[model samples]
Target: MAKSFQNFSILTSIVTLSVLMFSQGMLDTAHAEEYDFVAGIHNEVTFHFRNGIETVNFPVFSTTSDIVSNIGSSFEVEGVVGNNPYLHKALDEAYLYRMSTLSGGNSFEYNYRYFDVDVNIVQNENVLKSFKYDNCEISGYSVSTLTDDYESYLASDTGFAIVNNIQFRCGGVGINLDSDKSSLNSESRSFTDYGPLPFKLAEDVRTFLTFEFDHGSEKIESVIFTLTSGFSEANDAGPSFQIITAVLPHPLIDNAIDKSQKVSGMASTFNEDFDVSVEFTNSQETLRGLDFQDCIVSGYDILTLRDKEEGYTGKRGFATAEILDVTCSGLAPVNPAFDKLSDAKESRSSQMSNTYTTNSYNMGTGPHVIATFDFDSGTEVVDFPEFYQGNMIARANPTFTLVGVPGSTPLLYHVVDNTQGSGPKSTGVSSNVELFDVNLVLAYGNDVVRGFDYTKCRVVDYIVRTEHDADESFYKGFALTDEFYFECQGYEPFNPKYDELFETSHAKTESSSSWKEKQRDAWGPGFR
Candidate 1:
C-alpha cells in the first residue's frame, strides 16, 4: 500500500517573514495520477523511499494506473507512523485556509506536470541522486496500457508509474496560524516530519516514513496522481527554514502500540518551575520580604478548563491535573494532584467577583518588585492537557505582594495579610491597574479529598474584567472577587494574563468529600 499527499514546495512571503516547504528528491510535485485497470489483476512494484537517510521498502500493488493507491490490499503501507485518512483531509482544509489569505486568492494557482524518473550522479557525494522531477505537461495524460482484455497478456507496469504530485501554490500572502491544527489525539495517530513526499527525508532531519504490506486477493481499485511539484515567487527577509509535519492515521490493531501523542501551546513566558512572574514598576524597593513563613497553598489534584478571554468559562473538569514544584517567591516546592471534577457548582476563578470587600491600608515605603517566568514548551504543557484524560501538574507556585503608595485606588494591598476572616471566603485587595490578589494556602493537613485543599493557596493573578483604552487605568474599577478561587485552566497554561493571578481550578474537581470517599482517594490511586 502507498500513502498520498499534495501541495509540495509551497512558498509565501510578507513584509519581514517568509515561510515555505523545501525538499529535494524523486518527489518534486505530482497530482493524483489516475489509472484504470482491466479489473481483477494486481500490479506489484517495489515502492522504496528514504526513511531517515535509510531506505525503507514499501512493496505495493495497483489494479490501475491511478495515483491514489487503494490502501490495505495487495499490500498495506506500513510506517513507524500509522495511516490516518482524516489527517490528510484536515491538513488539506488547513492548506486551503492558509491559501485563502482572505483577499490574496487570485495569486494562487495549481500547475500539473508528468515526469519520467530523473537521476543525477553524486560525483562528490558518492551514490546516485536519482529522483522524479517534472519533465512534461500532463493535461490529458492517460495510463491505460498493456491490454484491457484480461484474456490477453496482463497489464501491470502502468500501475507502478502513477504517483501523485499535486502542488498548491501561494504567493504575496501571509497565512501562518495554528488554529487549523486537528483536534484528533496524537495517541491514535503518529506525527512524521512530512516533506513533499510521505516517504522521503532531508539531510539532517531524522524523521521519515517506512512501509509494509499485507498480501491479499483483493486488488487496489483506483490510483489518481493529480499535479507535479513546483513552488515559486518566494522571497524571504533573510535565510529561512520550514518543517512540514504530518499526522498520519492508524489502522485498527488487536493489541496496538503507541499511536497517540500531543503537543502543548503554553506561552513562552513561564519559568521552569511553572510560576507566573511579572514585571511591574512602582515607588518602593523590597516590597514584601520573607512572606512564605505564613504563606499557605491549598492542595488539589484536578485540572480546570479556562476560557481564553478574561471573564467567561472555557471548560471545567475537562481532565485530571497535578501541580508540582510549587514555589512562590522562590520558596520550597509543594506537589499536589487533583481529580477531574465536574463543572457544576461555581468554578469560575474571578478577581472582580472574588475580591469581595477591600479596606484601605498603609504599608510604609519600600522598593519596586519585578519578576518573570519562562513559558514551558508545548511538549511540556501537552503532557497532561485536560483534553487528554490524564493528570496535570504545575511545576511551582511563587508568592508575591502588590504594595501601593498613598492615593492609589484601594490605598494599600497585600496578597495574604490584606484578607480578613478565614476559610474559602477570605478577601484580599490591590489597587494597581495590573495587580491581582495573591493567596498562600498553607499545606498542613491541607490535602482535601476530591481535589479541594484547605491549605492556604496563593492568589496568582488579577482578573481584570473591564475593558478600557491605553490611557484608562484598570484600577478605576479594580476589585477582586474574593478567595473563593474556582477551578479553571486555559488552553495556554502559561498565558501572561493568568500569570500571578488567583486560580481556583480545583474547586469543581471534587467538592466536600465524605469519610469513605476520603479513605479511598485522599491519598488516592498512586499512593502505596
Candidate 2:
C-alpha cells in the first residue's frame, strides 16, 4: 500500500507543476497586452473647498502667486485621482502658494465638508497624462451619527453587512488646508484621517513628464510643470492645475543673453554678394607668363533712311543685302609661303596666218599651163584661263621695296570671287565682283588671326590677276590677261634704320611714288 501511495503522490506533483507553468505563461501574455501609464516627476498641489449645499460654488486655491501671473488667474476643476501626491511634492520644492476668492466678490469665503475626490497624476507639463482612481464608497452622512447612520443604512443587510458597509463608506475621509500666514488672515484648517488615506499611487510617474531647456536668458538646464487635483462636497471630483519652475545650470545667465544677441547681430550682417579686386604693381612682368586664346568676330550692320536721318542714334535700322567685312589684324608676322592651288590646266591652241607670194614662181610656166603652189602656216598659243592653270604664272618672288630700307618676305594675299561666274576671276577684273580677301599676317605663339582692331594694326592694299578670252570670235581659243598691285604702311617697322633722317626721307619718297602710280593706273589717260 505504501509503495502505491508514493507512485500516486509523484504523479500528482508533476501535474501540479505543469498547471503552475501554464498559469505563469497566461499571466505573462496578459501583462504584455496591458497599456503603459506613467506619472510626471514635477507636479503642482491644489486645494478644493466644499460645503454641504449642493447649489453653491466651491472655492479654489494655489500655493504660488507666480502661477496666477504666468498662466492666468482663473482656476478650473476636474475629476481624477493619484495626481495630488505629485503636485504636493512640486509645490513643497518650489515654495509657492495662492489664496482662493469667492465668485463675483473680492472677499474670501471659507467652507468645509467631507467629500469624495479623484486626482490625476500628470507626467509632464502637458495636460494629458495617465491616471488611476481609488476604490471606495462614500455617502452623504453626518459624522456625529456614525453608528446610528450605519445601523439605519444596514437595516436591510443580510449578515455582518452593517459593519462592513460603514467601514467601507466612511473609512477614508480627509481635509487639507494652507498654513502659510502671509497670505491668510486666520489660521488654516487641518486634516484628520486614520493613518494615510487609501489613495492609489502611480508606480512609474516619471516617464510622462518632459524637461525643456531655455538657452537664452535663463540658460536653464530644464523646465518642469506638475498638475494635480482634489474634490469638493458641492461638486463631483475634478482635474488638477499645474505649477512650473526652471532649473538653471549656473549663475552666468547674463553671458548667455549677450551671446544670444551677438549671434543675432551676426546673422543680420551676412550678405549674399561681395566684390573683390586686385591691382598689379608691375603690369608687364605680371602679364609675361599669361596666355590668351584667339577669338574671331564676323557680322554685318546697316544704316537705314531713318537711322541716317536720326544722325548717329546708335541703332541699326532696315538693311538691304548688308555686306559683312571680316578683317584679321594685330597678327604677328608669319613666313610668306604658298599653301595650295585650285583649278586644273588644259592645253589650248589657235591658228594665225601671214601670206607672201613669189612673183617669178609662175613666170617659167610652159604651154600656157601655170601651176600655183599654196603654202599654209600656223602658230600655237598655249592658252590657260583657269585660276590654277600650269601656263598661269605663280607669284613665287614678291618684292617689298620701302625706300632705302631693305624689305622682308612680303605678305601673301589672295582674292576669291565667291560670286557666280564662268571661271575664276580677280577683283581687279571687275568693279562689281564680290570677293573675300585672305591674308597671312603675323601671329604670336599658336593664336590664329582675327577681326581688326584699329589701335593695333591696319591693311593698306591688295593685288590680284585675272585671265579671259582675248577675242570675242574665238573666246575659247585665245587668252586675255589682267594683273593687280597693292601697297600698305602702318606702325613702326620691325627693322629700325641706322640713319633716321635718311630712312624718313626715303620712306616719304617711296610712299609718294607708290601713291602716284596707283592713281595713274586708276584714272590715267591709258585707262580712258
Candidate 3:
C-alpha cells in the first residue's frame, strides 16, 4: 500500500514547530547533495496545561508547496498526534518576559509544558533522515517584522524564530540517542546532541515564516513556516528527555512578602553547579551561610491572585542561590567535656586532702600561698577577677586579710579575711585621682609565693563581721575581734621587666619539714 499526501493546508492562526536539522549528513550522504527545505505535516497537536487538563488542536502551518513524495511516505508513523505538543505559547510568554528586562520589571511567570515535533530531511523523492524533537521548549526566541511594498503589488509580515533545546532523535525511538555511539559517530550521526543535553539546533535549524493576506477580504490567505535540511546523514539521531532527581544541598531561596520563591525571570538550564552568595537586608555580614539539605526549590515565581474584595499585592523582592548536589550526614555529641567547678574541687581535694572553714586556723602541709597586687589610682573594681592558679593559692576554702596602707590615701579602710559566706556587694571602689602605684603583699616568713603586679585594682565586695557573730563560743564577754572580706579588681597584669616581685617563694622552716613527714605517715604506704 502506498500512502500519499499533497498540498496540505494549515487551519489554525498560530503554530509552533521545533526543528534540529544537521548539515553533515546522517549516515552516508557522500553521493547525496544538499537536502531541499520541506514541510512537516502532523495532523494535530495535544497541549498539556498546568492544571492537568489536556487539549487537542490542529495548529496551522502554510503547506501549499508541501508535497510528500511516495518514497518519503515510509517515514510517516501510524498513530494519533504526539502526546507532547510544541510549547509555542510558553515560548512566546518567555520571550516577552525577556523583553521586559529593559524596563526593570525583572519578572517572568509561566508553567512548564511538554511537546513533541518532527524534522525531516529530503533530497528529491528520497527522505534521507527523519528525527523527532521530544519534550522540547523554546529556550530562546527573537522576532523581526517587516512590511514591504514593491510597486504596491504585495505586502508581507515576515519573521524568523531562533529556537534552542530541541532534542533530535534518529528513527524516533529512545532518549540519549548518541550515548552508545562514539564521539565521531555521535557528532556525525546525531542532529543536536553535540551541544548540551536537550541538544539545541544553532545554525541550520532556524525557522523563517511569512504571512500572506488577501487585501479584498482583509483576511490572512495562508501561513508558511518551513524546516529545511541542508544535508542528509542516515545516522543522524534526534533529541531526548533526561530524568533528573532533585538533589541536595539545594539552592538558597528568599521568603517573598507573599512567601513564594523564584529562580529566573525566563527559561533556565543549569548544566553545572551555580555558586551564589547573598546577605540579608540590614545584615552585618556580607554573605550569610545557608543550610538547604533537601529541598525541591520552586524554579519559578508564584504570581499573586486577585478577588473583588482583596486585590493583588504583586510579586515581592527575593534573592536566589544555586542548588547544590551533596550528601548529608548526622553528627554526634562531644565526648569528655570539661567542667571548671567540678574539676577544681577534685583537684584541690586530691592534692591537699583537707578543707578549711571560714576564720578557722589550720597549720599543716599545703600548697605555698602568697600573692601581691599593685594598682594605679582611678581603677574601679566590681567583682573578683579570677586569678591564675599558678599565681594564687588554690585551696579548698581559703581567705586572705586585705590590709590598707596609708600614704596612697586608702580607697579601702578595712582588713579583709578569707571566708566562705556570700560577701557584701561593695559599691565599686575608685582609686585616688593622683597617679601612684599601691603595693599589696602577702608574706610567709619573709618569702612571697608569687607576686601579681596589677596596673590598677579596687574593692568590688566588702563584708564586715565580729568574731562572735561567726563563732559564738570563740569570742565571749564582749572581747571580740572583727574580720572583713574584700573582693576587688579593675586591673591588668603589669610589666615584670626585671622585677623580682613576681618570683615565687620556696623558703622553708623547721616546722615545714615536720608537717611533711606527718602527712606521709598519715597517708600510709600509698603516699608518693
Q: Give per-model TM-scores.
A: 0.14, 0.13, 0.15
- In model 1, the worst 10-residue window by lDDT is 377-386
Error of 2 at 493 (Å): 63
Alpha carbon deviation, residue 300, candidate 1 (Å): 16
Q: Which stretches of candidate 1 lie over 4 Å from their true place?
A: 1-282, 285-324, 327-528
Question: How high a TM-score does candidate 2 get?
Answer: 0.13
lDDT of 2 by residue, 100-139 (tens): 3223222432222122333222233432211111222222
- The lDDT per prediction is 0.20, 0.21, 0.23
For all candidates, what are the clash counts? Answer: 120, 31, 26
Winner of 1 and 3 under lDDT: 3
**After aligning candidate 2 to the native by TM-score, how far in Å is the CA of 340 from where it should be?**
59
- Of the candidates shown, which would achieve the greatest lDDT relative to the real structure? 3
lDDT of 3 by residue, 1-528 (tens): 122222222322122111111111112211212211112212222233443322222211111110111111111211112232224345555566655534543243346433454433232433322334345333333332211224123322222211122211111221122222242233232221111111111111211111111111011101111111101111121111111111101111111100111222224632111111111111121111111122222221111111111110111111111111121121111111112223554766632111111122232443232233232212212111112222234432222333211111112221111111113323433232222232333224345443444333333223211111111111111111111232333233333333666788876655877898878888857655
Backbone clash pairs in model 1 (N, Cα, C under 3 Å; residues 3+ apart or in different chains), count = 120
Candidate 1 displacement at residue 309 in angstroms: 11
Model 2 residue 311 lDDT score: 12
